[model samples]
Target: MNGLSGMREENERLEGEVSRLRTELSQAAAGDGGGEKVNELLGEREAIQAKVEAMLDALAEIDPEIAAAVAG
Candidate 1:
């Protein structure tokens, strides 16, 4: 696949992961889950966020103006 298509797929996967982690975090906060579970969810969210940032950075390398607009 092309660069943008590959990145779009990665972005979608990461966004899905982030959404799932947020749901788990909320459930933990609601007391349906434990401290360890909450911590795990938080870690997963952080990892996904890092990946998204990296992808954005790559996009910036491809087109700084567009990336800046998207980042905003």
Candidate 2:
């Protein structure tokens, strides 16, 4: 019961993080900034996206329905 609750909490947290990271990535892409800065943001976004994917993978094991909702 506690473990299920914890998984739900973690799932929500990861979903929020993924949303925030995606918003940041979109904003960064929209900006007309320096090439170096854009490249840096792209790298950061890639790292964040990777983390999100990993979290979703773990979540799928704990709760496939929630994971599918998040992924979709």
Task: State which candidate has the highest TM-score.
Answer: 1
Q: Could you tell me how far off, in angstroms, the CA of residue 59 lies in candidate 1 after the best superposition?
A: 0.2
For candidate 2, write residues 1-72 as lDDT tens digits.
255666567657766876776676677777777456667767776776687577667777888797779777
Q: Candidate 2: misplaced stretches above 4 Å?
A: 1-33, 67-72
lDDT, model 2: 0.69
Q: What is the lDDT of residue 32 in candidate 2?
A: 78
Per-residue error for 64 in candidate 2, Å, reads 2.7
Task: Give candidate 1 misplaced runs (Cα > 4 Å).
Answer: none
| Candidate 2 TM-score over all chains jointly | 0.52
Superposing every Cα of model 1 onto the true structure, what RMSD results?
Answer: 1.9
TM-score of 1: 0.82
Minimal lDDT window, size 10, model 1:
25-34
